[model samples]
Target: MANVNTAPSWHAPHAGFIRVLVGLFTVAALVVIAMTLAYPGPDPHTIVLVSAGISLVALNIVAFTLPWGRLPRRHTFWLALAQLVITILLAGTLYQTNNAIPLLALIPVLWIAFQLDWPHTIAIIVALGLGCIAFWLIVEPMPSRPRVIVAISVFYFVVASLAILTQANADALRRSRAIAEEAWRSQQDALASAESNAAVMRAIAHGVDAAVFFASQDRSSTFANQRAQELGRRMGVSAQDPTWAGHEVYGPDRVTPIPPEDQLLPRALQGEYATESLQWVGEPGAQHAVSVSSLPAVTEAGEQVGAVIVAHDITNLVEALHAAESFSATVAHELRTPLTSIVGYLDLLETDDLDETGREFLRRAQQGVTSLSAKLRELLEPFEVAGASPTFSFIDVVDLLRRRVNHWRESAGTRGIVIEGPDGSSRLQVPLDRELAERMVDAVLSNAVKFSASGGRIEVAVDTHENSARITVTDHGLGMTREETRHAFERFYRAPTAIRRALPGFGLGLATALSIAQAHGGTIRLESAAGAGTTAIVEISLTQVGVAARGSS
Candidate 1:
């Protein structure tokens, strides 16, 4: 719909050509005045002719003062045409005197050729040729009229043709220069973008703390950042090797070599993602824990072109966990010794004769000491069971729940808190660690009794589903907000209400319960709202129980 080859409209004669035309007009006017004065023509006729020549010169001078170079193309064309008409009239008047004034027509013809394109210049040239013939026949009665007309027309045509060619060449040269400049600018932009990308890559290689490694698709070439090189050296790997795909990697034991296929880099190259922590022993017997992650590198087209591996040192975290476990064991042992002594003293005082009030105080002291000892043992169970596999045994689900519930009945009764269990008893056998299962139930029941108000009721229910057992404990007490329930199982987290009520707890009950449930491939769900009640449901899979039964058979 648009013309693609349209020419620019602003092309016009250069300012130098306009100045030359003005100078030529001034010289022609002076020559006319001098010739008239020397020839001594009729006074009135000479005055009229001299005044007309001088006025044409004055007009040319004024045109020079105008900003011709900045004028629009159409306006500039009309200005050149006006000057040409004036030149024609002056030349016709002088030629009537039989002088060589016809040559002055060349000025207007040249100006038109330089200022206009081929179409406009040719039209003006034809008009000037007609004017030359008319002047020769009508305004002047000179001999050899046809020869004069032919000479003037031939000269103007030649000059106009030359000017058209020159203007076209200049326009083409300018257009070529503009295109070259645009190409140069694009090249500069591309080069700058490449430099910026390289700088960012270099900064990341040196600035990041994590070890970074990159490998080509075929594993023939590899790149390792500074941190990665250090990690490789510590692991006895050749950091500078180009082909390290099949290199041996050590496991946590530091003695057995891990399979090449199982290593992070190899797995990643196979389009698999991997993240794991491995322990290594250095020359000085220092333990180092390194976490490695590997992922396939994908391009914009979604093609897996290579892989990236990142490794991080976690030695401090591992050491801290070990130290914390040791501290917990030491504290539990130190506290148990004094608590056992207090319980023994209370037992001895009970046997001796004393007043009823004193005996009641002794009983309360014994109960407090016993409860403290139990909690201390429960708190240490996680550390104690670390790395120890559970010993599975078939146990009656109903009987286990009944025995644990009865153990808490006395304590609940003290506050008029009633605990209700399932109505009927059935032999629902489940394979689990008996002691661990009892401990899990104890945590749930303890929280129920501790939070229940006087005369409140705690309900316990057990049911067997397809391949699992579900245990639900509901308590009508000062419940928790939704936000508090979300974090109820987090270690050391106590609800705001529990803290305000000054409840005696270490905030470890629910967390310990969750750990125990997860060990048996189970999950625990809590439901509660402020001012309502709280319900805890624990689900444990029975697939392992069935497997154990078949193995025994």
Candidate 2:
């Protein structure tokens, strides 16, 4: 911000006001000259002096109004001095007649003081004072009175003081006015910027579907968006009280009161960052599950100022989880009772009394029962998969995969789907949990058969790459879009295409397969496109904790 004011250099402090004052002085001088010219019996000397005074008045007008900046800097002092000389001579000539004519000297002295610096101003004042005194002694008869002498001295002193004081006050006032105007403009700019930022923040806080709020350290000031205000009222916070308190907050259990020290807002204000601290607010019958997260507001110097808190309504998610737990409990109790009775009966029917074919069928029935038990256990494992560790056994991966493919063939054939396999009889030994590996394979193979069109082909392969085993299962059938494929392995996330086609599935197949693969220190991924097909690859690491090295087959 440099001052870029383009006003001309000739522009004076209060230029218009100065012009008005000078104009008045010119008019007054003209009236005096006119009065002198109109005298019925004017002397020739007086007549000549009146004409000279008129000419000087006209010159004074031009000098005062001209743009002094058009001339050189030196010309200013000379021109100002010339104007003062004219004023002095004209006043001296007319003083004997008008007596009051000496007052006109004030015009030039004041102008010089206003337009020039102190040194030049002092010179002009001294010259005007000497000229007036000289005219008083030489131009007219002296009234030898002590009162007249004292009055002249006092008048000159007062005039000089008035000029100096007026100029100083004028300069100070101009400077103050300029500063005030600049400050006003700066305040306007700051106010507009602050308002614009507030508008953007309002949109962001309200645009999102979450409850957002802010508060000062002492809880004396606060801000909350529309949703937060609604949530606040619902949480039993009074409209008049501070948003920080006036409500009872409970933990996720919806029964235990959350102590003030453990609460999200209190902790954050105390300079802690707390995230996803679940709270149940409002009365028991009308409570809502809110996941509140908080961060301490701090200055650049790391001094804690206040707190910022965001809350999300997790009522649906919490309710869904509760329902799932209850449903699992009910299903487990009902199914296990009948399953136990069936196992007891099967054990009582001894295969020792049966023929070879009967014993073979009996053996198959027992295996099917064992598989059902394994399926139940797999279903429950997902609830605790993140912390579950696999118990590894040195097992042949190829054999296990081949057996799974063989077992799935009959079921796949009912839809005319044919299964392929890893080429040749090769043993690829890897450390793995045997039953979990079989379950992972079964999940992938089942999905391949279920989604494939009639007579569609499937390929299963297990290969040794470096020190790891890779299992790939590919099917030529309906596939999925990129968006759908991204989330297809999330539990219960059936693809839109699958759901539209009325496919029978819980969308749990790939999720289960993925969990088991990761448990074995492996990864499962799919490459898919709509109407093209899908290829699922499961890769397992050869190394495992506490397991000795096994050779590749």
Best by TM-score: 1
lDDT of 1 by residue, 264-375 (tens): 6667767788766564534435546778888887888999888988888878866775686677778988898888888887888886578899989987888888788877
Candidate 1 residue pairs in backbone clash: none
Residues forming the 10-long window of minimal summed lDDT in candidate 2: 544-553
How accurate locally, in lDDT, is each candidate?
Answer: 0.73, 0.74
Which parts of model 2 have CA positions greater than 4 angstroms off? 1-16, 23-89, 95-187, 218-220, 239-243, 299-304, 354-364, 375-553
Per-residue lDDT for 80-195 in model 2, tens only? 46556655666666655566666666766776676556787788778878875765564545665676567567768877887797668757765876777677667766676778
RMSD values, in order shown: 10.9, 12.4
Task: Report how far off residue 52 is in candidate 2 (Å).
Answer: 7.8
Off by over 4 Å in 1: 1-198, 201-205, 220-223, 239-258, 275-278, 281-284, 295-306, 387-389, 396-428, 441-545, 548-553
Clashes in each model (backbone N, CA, C under 3 Å)? Answer: 0, 0
TM-score for each prediction?
Answer: 0.53, 0.50
